[model samples]
Target: MKKNLNFLMGAVLLMATVLFASCNAEDDFLVSPVDSTGAVTRSVTTDPYVIDFANVPAAYTASDKYGANLYTGGAGQITEGYKVQLGNSGTYVQFPVNYLEQEWGEEPRPWQYDYWNGGLAVSDYTDITDGTYLNQCSVYNGGIAGVDNDKFVVAYGYSDFYNDPLSTYDKCAKIYLTDATGYTVVEEGTPVEGTVKTGTFNSVYVCNTTYSQIVMRDGNSFTTGGKSLEEQEGWFKVEFIGFASSDTSVAPTGKVTYYLANFDKSKEEESGLHGEIRTGWNQVDLTDLGTGVHMVVVNFVGSDKSDYGLNTPAYCALDNLSISL
Candidate 1:
């Protein structure tokens, strides 16, 4: 979610300079935006706290420091101001920032949570004043350490800047999760629709399994764990077909529009690039769904696929994700 939209950065600062009114706490406590002045606007450039994957150090060299959080990036080096708590314990917090080094810019992690209520970009999630409702489940994949978090199999997702845990924490913590089966992981051996090996960026150039003489030249060599995928790069995308809920039975009554792109979308459309995520950041707009979301079952689609399976890693860094109260 980490976007480099400097063109609109000034707007956030300019708006913050002015003071606004507060909202009614006793009213719709978990459903609407509570700007004291009654008018609150949020964008990638303007949010109380943006969870851009800045935690992964810019230096992803062949050093042990790069091993930060091999799995879901714990809150080790995330941008200051937010605290991520996994499961119900409220301990061992980690900022989700993976060490992604690529030819272009680098800050991409795939979605990996089990369930989601929705994403938020409120004024102050810390106090929970103007109706801020959130899903209070274990926000990670592979289930929580000791607890039984596998019950929520349908898989829901959320991303934001606040860190207001459901418990009695002062700051507005935010939690995120994705269904490993439907949203991100296709497993090591899954039967994909078409032939995975298309003459695309994924099959020809980036996949770790796909050998190439241009490996080092393309800056795609990760020697730490000797893991082939340590070098996965570029922005990957997934279209939540039908309903945002991962329930294959329910039909998606809405659409998924993007708010970030360097070029005109039309230019990319009508070709393979259409709907496919590019090298830069893209704001995935899910406002149509509102907050009445439980389990999200998407007719998932990806950009990377090998003749064997999904090779284009399904991860990307997140930032400036806004949600209404």
Candidate 2:
């Protein structure tokens, strides 16, 4: 009887150990591993690709050579003006003059003409009340038509700009796209949270001080047949442009910052892309993206560390936003 009782106790302990081991295995499957190399790798069983707004068509005025109003507004107010044009290349679309006013502050902060000591210097506008302006601009061409339908991937690149600070925000631009109905905000640029990418420079009015910073959010997205495309097969691309002023009274400094974020419900956290002080633009490619409705968000940040505090004014331009396939 004694021997039988001992045997039964041993059996019960073994069973408990086995059960505990099984539970641990299950937990391991749910949590991913963090490698020592500072790189994270995960095993995704579902579709990995998604669409992004890179280059959407721009809204042009009746005077534009590329058919007037090729892109019409869908949900928001549409303005008619000469689409912001890139230099001599004619490769990019243009941003509107009121972009900053529409995106950030309510009032228009006009440039202030002032004098310091014995020389003449201008007051750089910083408050959102000052207004929206674009002093610089550029364009990017993401090779889309060449890739196969299966190769649905897009990317956007960002670079730095050098010009007058006071006129940086004079007229910024962004690209948009429309389906059979009209244009929708496919991709655009916005202000970022930090300093501009370029080096430090003197403020227009505060000549004794030098500061550098330009933060704006710029991005693009993709859509199909008038609907937000979030499937694994869709793709998109975009590029950023920086504009500056020519007058010494309006010296602009800073490089473009880049960010890419996805709006899918499943992958919200890992859906963001970013780059800073980049010599060139950064590219984000979403291939084999999931299906359904989707949206892509781009962010641009500027830095202002002048005597005016963190509120020093800045500006940028967007253009050549497009979508295909």
Candidate 3:
């Protein structure tokens, strides 16, 4: 009997030891440094490059009379030539700009216009539903007119703020320009890129002379060298590229949240203009962007909880906004 008991005790001890070893192996796997194989993933460790507001060019700092106020209610007017509508229930109005004719004389080129009823018209402008419409206005006589006239009408759709006013995120979109030289501009059809998971959406616009405009997910937008008397001459659209995420576990879902920086009201008031302008990183998702030969724009949309206004108006700044693989 004593011999049998000893054997049983020994077996139990051996089983316990095996179980403990298995647990230790799992712990080591969790903490081990990942191999640098192409298959093995790594996080973006390099700190994002921040823009030096002091380095802003004189052209970027110039005042823009055409700069539109975003907070105005109902079919807000953008400069003397453009009008914007707010809300979900409304008729689609055509936009007529003389600049189109001045740029492409006698030739009727395809022009894309963004409609923001509920939120800013970003890349999702193509996803216009019954409640929202981002219609392309036909060009005539090389130029579309109707700034002081009623030829163009502004429309609106459902207001995200009405449903949830306390929400931190705001739905917005922007257009940018890009040319053969790989210079991106803030123009029509600029691709919007970013991740809108849970609540936060941030993105950076790489501001370069090669690039023209930095359209925000919010209704407000900016140009690099300020506004020129010749409009369409310097404006074009950027193609869609991809984005990178700081956290790999939370894979981006081709959506983004809204963040406003650089322009502070108190600071703007302190200065002669609206506010001091600063530049920082704008976070985004790059899942949609494929490899090589593409431009990108970032947009943010969601329930309205944040204010879209700058006490100081300034050009948009961007850095390290690129796609790899």
Local distance difference test values of all predictions, in order = 0.24, 0.23, 0.24
Deviation from native of the Cα of residue 184 in model 3, angstroms:
11
Candidate 1 residue lDDT tens string, 46-77: 12222222232232111121222222343332
Question: For every model in order, what is the number of clashing pairs?
Answer: 45, 85, 46
lDDT of 1 at 269: 47
lDDT, candidate 2, equals: 0.23
Task: Please identify model 3 stretches exceeding 4 Å from their true place.
Answer: 1-56, 62-288, 304-325
- Model 2 lowest lDDT segment of ten: 113-122
By descending TM-score, how would the candidates be arranged? 1, 2, 3
The residue ranges of model 1 lying beyond 4 angstroms of the native Cα positions read 1-236, 240-249, 253-267, 270-279, 295-304
**What tens-digit string does per-residue lDDT give for candidate 2 at 1-325?**
9999999999999999998898544221222222212223223212111111122223221112111222234222223222211111111121222222232235564221101000101111122211122211111112111112111111111212432134332232222111121222233433211111111111100000111112222211211222322332221212232222222133222222232222234433333422222112233222222121112212122232223221222222121122111
lDDT of 3 by residue, 73-113 (tens): 32343321221111111111111111111123365543222
